[model samples]
Target: MFRTRSDKVSLVMGHVIVTRGIAELPAVFFTAIMEAVRRFDDFTEHNDPHGEHDFGALTVSGERIFWKIDYYKRGTEEGSPDPSNMVLTERVLTVMLAEEY
Candidate 1:
């Protein structure tokens, strides 16, 4: 029913992880980054060739930021064999400052 695998990724969006670098940002800048991530929809062939919409980069308050969604076997560290199956996958979205990458 979803248009893409990304549409099915909502189940994992709740599991956000901000890296240490991002955690140290000022509250205003941090909030901006989070809001940007929520509103992001600039996918293109160059930035999202796979069309998974699992990764993105943006700038907030002049600071570069990067975010990525990774799929893993639910409750395990291994990569998921089928990322489309939400029941079998645990998606972790990690947000970090570009310099931290």
Candidate 2:
């Protein structure tokens, strides 16, 4: 929702965070990684056993990367009591290199 639809994301207080390793990549590679993440849809039983579409792995420019979305309480560092309740939840999407896992 974050990559393709900003208006919807704003309703849930969505945020995107890139790790240090990913931030240091060249502009081309960084752009490629973001694009790859936006297009990622390779979920399977092995990687998505829980059926929560909040995590994914992909490769860009020969480098493996992972992205995950976590729910938190707005204006606090605690996890949200009800992620489904957009009124009280904030979504934080983190992107990082595989090695950083």
- Give the lowest summed-lDDT range of ten residues in model 1: 1-10
Q: State the lDDT of candidate 1 residue by residue for 1-101, as single tens digits.
A: 11244544433333789999899888988898989987788899999998888899998889899999888898999999998787898778899999999
Q: Report the lDDT tens digits of candidate 2 across residue range 1-101.
A: 45333324333348899999999999999999989987777889999998777899998889999999988998899999997777898889999999999
User: What local distance difference test score does each model get?
Assistant: 0.82, 0.85
> What TM-score does model 1 achieve against the real structure?
0.87
lDDT of 1: 0.82
Q: When superposed on Cα atoms, how far off is each prediction in RMSD?
A: 3.3, 3.5
Report the C-alpha displacement of residue 35, candidate 1, in angstroms.
0.4
lDDT of model number 2: 0.85
Error of 2 at 68 (Å): 0.6
Give the TM-scores of the predictions, in the order they appear.
0.87, 0.86
